[model samples]
Target: MEKDRRSLILDCAKELFATRGYHSTGISDIIEKAQVARGTFYLYFDSKRAVFDVLLESAFETILSSVKPVIVGPTPDRNNILKQLRINLGRALAPLFADRHLARIVVSQAETLDEVAAARMEAFYAALRHYLEESLQEGQEKHVIRQLNTKIVATAAVGMIKGIVWTHATGSESFDYHEVVEEIVEWAAMGIVTR
Candidate 1:
């Protein structure tokens, strides 16, 4: 099927990009890894950069889509809010933890591609910051979160998660996702919730 072939090409390209690095990867390498003819590859992607673009977009979609807005009910239980935070984080982290290749590509190789790629990554982070800032503002209005600079807090939170992912992707030792998620939730709860 056409869809299957396209997915095959994408999977192979993701593997190659993560292992070989974007600049080092070429169309020939991707086609060879994909076991597809030159023309077949062209049918799906115009170039290696095109393939990289699709992969990057896919990664962004997965993470951003995972973040469901934390719902504050009338009761507004602290435990419930923390539970929602844990759920959101776990969902967001699941794909990356499951696929080291994807994690490496998104965290390490995304910004290295070119100016366009760097800008795309920046935009992705900006979207994340905006979402966090909005959520923090809502929490403050609901009296669930303390008063603080939402912009700075959002930026710092995004940076912390990025740094954690970068370390996990690039480090030799593997981490347990559940533990990481719990630690992050605890740290966030301590910093975010009103006493």
Candidate 2:
């Protein structure tokens, strides 16, 4: 089927990109790995960048879908906000845990590809920041959190999470995602300063 072939190409491309890095991987490489003809690859994607773009978009979609359920409905109160945050963190990390390749692409490699790719990465962060900002605003309204600059707070939170995820994905190894999530949520909700 056409869809299956396209997916096959994408799967092969993702594996190549993850293993070989985007710049090192070429169109021919993708086709060969996919076991598809050159013309078949052209039919599905115009170029390597095109395939990378699609992969990045798909990863973002997965992240958005993962986080949507936790934050979309009723606002959480003080008692439940921490629990909600934990759920949100767990869901956010699920895709990355499942696919380190996708995580590497989104977190580190995309921006290095080109200006358009960099902008796409920026937009991805913006989307995450927007979601965090909305949640923080809702928390403020509910008097669950202190009055703060939601934009700055959201940006910082997203940056922290991304930094940890990137390090875990690309660094030496032995990083536990649940521990990262737990520490991040604890710090985000309760500051380091002791009372």
RMSD of 1: 1.2
Report the lDDT tens digits of candidate 1 across residue range 123-159. Answer: 9999999999999999999999999999999999899
Candidate 2: tens digits of C-alpha lDDT, residues 1-195: 999999999988888888789999999999899899999999988989899989999888888877853342364444456667788788888888777878888887887888989998899889899987887776666566678888998888888888877876685564687887789878966752111
- Give the root-mean-square deviation of each candidate in angstroms: 1.2, 2.9
What is each predicted model's overall lDDT from 0 to 1?
A: 0.90, 0.80
Cα error of candidate 2 at position 189, Å: 2.9
Q: Assess candidate 2 and give its lDDT.
A: 0.80
* Total colliding residue pairs, candidate 1: 0
TM-score of 2: 0.87
Candidates in order, TM-scores: namely 0.96, 0.87
lDDT of 2 at 193: 14
Measured by TM-score, the strongest candidate is: 1
